[model samples]
Target: MIVKPRLPVINRAHPLAKGLVADYPFFERGGTTLRDISGNNNHGTLTSMDPAVKWILTSQGYGLDFDTTDYVTIPDSDILDFGTSPFFVETWIKTTVNNVRQVAVAKADVTGNFIFEMGTYRTLTANEIYCEFYVSGLYPKVLVVDSSFFDGKVHHLVAGHDGTAVRLFIDGVLRGSNVSAYGNIDTASWAIGTYGAYSPPFRGWNGQIAKTRVWKKAPIAREIATLYADPWALYRSRRGIIGKAVAAAGVTYPQLERSFQRGAFRGIKMGVAA
Candidate 1:
């Protein structure tokens, strides 16, 4: 006789009753509005929001541009209110140049309270991409991705914290985890694209970004998978030219490549003349 393996059962009155149970421990479709940030009808890059700022667009992707003054500012009213517990931040980004300074795109206070930062640093010969989180301190708990892992290509980055430990993700895969001493992000003037008083100030972005989102509660593995699978479903259903190029060429969008190549060539010619 053939028999199926039995699954574990849990009481309905359990504290985790709202989420998936042990028997069916996976989230159903369209549970959260995280996809709505990208919208449901549009594709391509998220050009600009309702309020206009002096952000320089280096490529066609969401969060591709960085404003000199402040890319995005969250007022006290809209600040994500947490109850001294866990939280998560997720976004997809395409890096333009290796070893360049660029924030991972996050919300933070002016003095630096709840912030997520991602950038690259050059060693003797190679470059490493690293992510750090600061709740209320000078130094942060950092997770670094080796140069070989980061190739100036598109990657999905996720940071999750629960007052004691911090975790990092790349392309939906768990990369590294670290322990920290801080918790809860209660700050003012949350900014993205740049940290507080960092060098290469207001330089702006140089690549594409998509499906940027934030959640008040720490997301489980299944939710993270769903976000990675269909990042732009809520914002727009159809893929744009950029998406097509990536699928066919195994590289970034053609237009972005052309822009960078042309710009670099022009710069080289100018330098030779001088």
Candidate 2:
């Protein structure tokens, strides 16, 4: 028998929740609209449906599927306009397409002068999944994963600048990091499943994307690991050992106290290493 751990309770007013600007759960069964659960009204509009987009059962519940010609368009908003602030983009994806640059998520202007994309790129030897942030006149930071996730298996991909470095994580493990200046992203719109009109030849992603999240604040290594463990769980991003211990077990205040009195959680390491 497989045992599923109980999910933790999250405080909605916590800073972690507030820092999440765009959250696409893709929970709807059938519709052209994909609602943003971040409470910031950053809903995505579907366009150019070749076979009509719809939600299907994925490893992580219901997820929206996009054909090669379909994509989701999110209008420009202050919440998405990160002006040199630390930011991260994450999504759960599965695809078998190779030899093509496919975009999972992107923010770009109509002319594609400046663009930011978190997607898969084609290389001579293999395809690479990366998070790229670029400025019109500046060098862009592209953090790529060493291994590919194109085996038709659902995998987690995350790319972001954590204040000091641009990092990429696959399935909760840090794969690559680079130190560079990620210029501000001032695009007029954001697209999921395609790169709009970016200069790069990367086009729409022909796969299944379960969820996508954008955070204005940089997530540390521990937080990234925690996210890989429980993608939907909400906890304080920057917390001490004690706070992290409680979250690791998904215990409430009372449960934590009881566990302490019983010495059940003693000597238990916290964070991702645990």
Global fold similarity of model 2 (TM-score): 0.76
Local distance difference test values of all predictions, in order: 0.44, 0.70
Residue range 1-274, candidate 2, lDDT tens digits: 1121222233465545657888886655465777786778898877765323356667764576776677888889998988888888888998887667788888887786545777777766556777776644764556463455888877888888776777888888888877877677665688888885554234878889887889898867777787778664553333546666656877554355346446776764322111
lDDT of model 1, residue 33: 12
TM-score of 1: 0.55
True-vs-predicted CA distance for residue 5, candidate 1, Å:
49
Best by lDDT: 2
Worst 10 residues of 2 by lDDT: 1-10
For candidate 1, give the lDDT: 0.44
lDDT of 1 by residue, 1-274 (tens): 1111121122334322233211111111112111221112111112233222222222223233333332433333223544465767776666545565556554455543545555443444445556666655654655464555466556777776756677777676667678775555554333344543233234334454443555556656666666566443222213444345445765533344355445643432210101
